[model samples]
Target: MLNKFTTKIVSLSTLNNYSFIIPTYQRPYVWGEEQIKKLLDDVLLSFTTNKESIYYISTFLTKEVGDKAELIDGQQRFTTLWLIALVLSEMTSNNSEISTFLKKGDELRLSFEIRDEIKNYLKALLKKESTSKFLNEHFIKKHPYLENIAEALSTIKGYFLQLSEDYNLNEFGNYIYTNVKLVKNTTPTNTDLNKLFTTINSAGIQLEQTDIIKARLLNLIKDEKIKFSRIWESCENMNNYFERNVRQAFPNWKSFNFKKPFDFNDNLFQHNEDVIVTNPKDIFSIDDLLEHDYETVNINTDIKSNQTEEINENEVYCRSIINFSQLLLHTYRIHLFKEGKTDFPEEFHSKNCIAIFNEMIKRNNTEEIKRFFKLLWKVRFVFDIYIIKWVTNIENKTEQLELMNINSNTDGYYSRTKYEPSSNLMLQSMLYFTGDYLRQYWLTPYLNYLLQDFDNVAPTNNSHLEYLEKMDNIISTRGGKSEKELSFEYLKTNEFTQQRLDIEYFNMHLGTGFKHYWFQKLEYILWKNWKDREEKNFKNYRITSRNSVEHIYPQNPENRIQHPEIENKHLHCFGNLVLLSVAQNSEYSNKSVSVKKSMFGEKKHTYDTLKSFYIFQSNQWTPKEIEEHKSEMINLLKMHYEKTFF
Candidate 1:
């Protein structure tokens, strides 16, 4: 029966030929704005980055029932794609595209089992009978699952609307319809559907390529394999600090202290020579590790002990921006750059990590492999201290990108001190939100910068901040340079200079089509130079992941007569636009400028960008006010550019 299963790769256009049905046992649609936006952005990026490239979205496991295919997996992604088709159909206003691609005559290509409300809601949206207000009021409240679909629809619509000015909508729509693809795996009819579903749901996570690489590398090192494996495990635990990971990994070792939390030295695992260490029972050799099936192997049994340090419940949870695979790639890039290899790839994708390292291993010696692992340890130490993490606030449960300064007490216990937000955190947060969430290109060069003087002494917070600010300017102004070229330039020279911003060349009226980076960058500049009596209002401000570009003077206001003085041409301009979260954008939807200002005043803390707050400071929004605000903001940006780049 397993041999009878069939699989084929199909483009979105080809996928449209078959109809799909979600089983009654399937989970409800749970993807929110973040997931939906990511899909939209990823597809858009694929189209823009390489239009000819066939982007494989994901694999879908299904079982054929008569003419319809029952989706066993990949429903979330497929549903999102269907919603995208709906959005494109509405934008183009061509029912044929929908009929041919997403629907069979008037019937949707996809349907839910025992879920009529959702099916009806989708039909209403397709027929143009559903409005944003209608979704919020009627269907969403009754059918809770519809909320995600509604939000997804809004997110898709808003994403396209925002990028309309910058991208070719027709071309993008066509690319999504034709270029995007999925792999469909059809199970045999004889297969037990219930058993298959149970197995899939109860399955454990598959072994990562990193795990394979670890095994392969450890097989080569006859001596100190356990110690190196421990080091690799410590670096893999990115959530906790490096020192804490080291302590957890080496539980029996007493008197452990890093020169500093940020600094790494050779004596990290070295303990008192007088202490007798007992090796764990039944240790497996590299050959045994390589030959055994990872699923059946009890790899943790050797390390597991009752004396192991328990995790502290009160400790702040900090999430690393990049995963272990990405960190390994970054560390490997730095290692190659240091070894006088200038052609290493700058872009990072976890899927390609094994291949990237495989090429490296084939060319380098076993000793070099050991060195790479050691460098990974050192890199992670600096990364934890210097990088901005999504630190969770215990009380509010809100996460913010923060770089907490580590303070060591006289007794050698490290505590995270609440340091005031510095330019380092602000600039990193700005770069973080502005760049690709998956491919953080800035870290490669920035991590290399930290590694340059790492052995002598760790850099002070002020100097580190200055270096990052300069890197930010270079990244912002490096108009057409490839990421590899930019990384090489950053590595090869001390003088980091790039193209300067020409204020005249920038379209102040780009509105939704404007690059989000500029808005986020301006926010950083405003926050850095803030000195108003309302300092308390602006002090806690940090740039977050915001996709919606809001207009101060609403494009379609509820009260039409509220802002008649504002001209249509100035409505989408930089002066009127501010980057905001999707929820906030929905909250401020189509309100009058005065009402929006009143809403801003009502909040105790201002979550809006400082630039937006500045605009709201004016009582009435008029063409005169817009022009005045535009001039001031442009000058501010230009001045900062000059100060940083010149």
Candidate 2:
């Protein structure tokens, strides 16, 4: 009678009406990078390769109550799957249909019975906050178990962050809800579950894998199960902190992928000796975490007033999006001498990167564990400083900000202008080189000397000048050319700029979609060089703009050319693509040259006047003009920057 239980191969959608309660007596959610990656890869592969096929995601043992199920044996798997659903919900939070499916009364309500804090955390997550952000602000500072959950969640979030580039969230969510099945075994309500669950595992003492890990970690940090657990769990989600903070630190970071926890996390704390010192009040204290409730914790404004340093809302939002694996490869190859001190391979591939980190903890060295967090904070600060550039050094890039400042002079007449950038083109150029997704080969080394106060990438002091120099050397080494160098070479060197162009370099990554940022640059460049200059500089023009690239000539033109011999490849060349506002792009979609030009003047503010002016320079568009304009652009841009293509 104790052995008998019901089983069902139900789709996730079927569980919309049923809530899940992970009993606190169960182990903490310990699915690290290995389990997180596998589940994501399997589910994604299933969704894409065979949409209709049912993927059996192992058995989950639970006991159904009135509207909820008490997870008995398969809590980890169920918790992971529930997290996957949360990821989907997060991505599509704006869609009413999906929002209802994810959060309505009929939809699943996952709560932890043991820790109301953890349950409160989940409830906060559904309210559209970054999981890692919530982790750091609340639980990571205090609760050890939640820290583990946070790391696992971060790894999970990081994987999906990568997949989001190639895979459709809507499709993935649909398949996961409607097709993916799991064998759920509900034990009879009368069974002695604690003993049964314990017997099912090898530990035999009712100890879980988490408990075993806890026991092992306990040796390193004696008399502090609570403290060590908090530190250890935070490391697991350490990747999240890296991904989120680094993204805001640099541009094009959102599309970056960190497949493993150690990818960025371990590199952030490669060595323990180099601890960055900061005020104790800067970091949230355990008392601060415990004193706050979910709402209070979620309200970042409440915490900032008590802090020694105040970060603005824009900076706070900027720090929330991050990805940083490519940099890890650099550190992996150079700093670690091609391998971790532990046996885990030195290469920066696969989820097993954490193996070396686990080996660090396995040493039972409390200092080593402590060092990891210290280094992590240092790296976090470094990334945080770079994010400040979004608000700080932006004027250097000639970025047109939205804000307007007004003043009254002697006559009491109002005068107005956007605040100006303090720096020049070099700052913007190198910032984009390191920040851009496709143009990542020219990356700088992580120099400790370049580090100043805080965890910021850019120093707070004069060392930042050296960081800028390093950026130039790195970018130049990896084939990125400055506007000045390229412009001079094109004009004086008589650079065969167009012919030497790598056609594939312009090709967008199918997975990462890295080419779109070029339009922003191009838009800035075109506006800067506009023959029809306004009193205000293009860089300082306060106008709302969309960064989406659209083909000036229709990609698939309705008005067929007399010479249809032109290849489709030439259609996407820099000559043909132009930055357009969303509404403007839709209006000009597949329209003929004559028609686009007629309205181009009307909506000129939404487009690059130079590009539009050049387009209207001809009566009709053909492969000949496309080639001519391509060379013209190459020539004009080179002349503009005094640099040229090889």
lDDT per model vs. reference: 0.73, 0.47
- In candidate 1, residue 517 scores what lDDT? 84
What's the CA error at residue 101 for candidate 1, in Å?
Answer: 3.5
Model 2 TM-score, all chains together: 0.40
> Once superposed on the true structure, which residue ranges of model 2 sit more than 4 Å away at CA?
1-319, 323-356, 388-537, 540-549, 555-574, 579-584, 598-600, 603-620, 633-646
Model 2 per-residue lDDT at 361: 61
Give the Å error, residue 262, model 1: 7.0
TM-score of each: 0.86, 0.40
Candidate 2's error at 167, in angstroms?
A: 13
For model 1, the run of ten residues with the poorest summed lDDT: 272-281
Residue-wise lDDT of candidate 1 within 1-646, one digit each (tens)? 3336778888767765578899988999998765776677667767877888777789888888666799988899999888888887777665324335678656888999988778888877767774644455454767778877777777787778867776767677778777888888888776666666655554434567887788777777767776777778778867777666676566543455454444334564643333223222244432333244344433232233234564545556688888898898888888887777755552356767777777766764777878888888778877877788888888899777888666565745465645577777888888887876666778888888787654434333667767777777776787677555676568765656767886864545676778778888898888778877356777767777777888888888888666564565688778888888766777788889888888888878755778778898897788888888988999988888787766
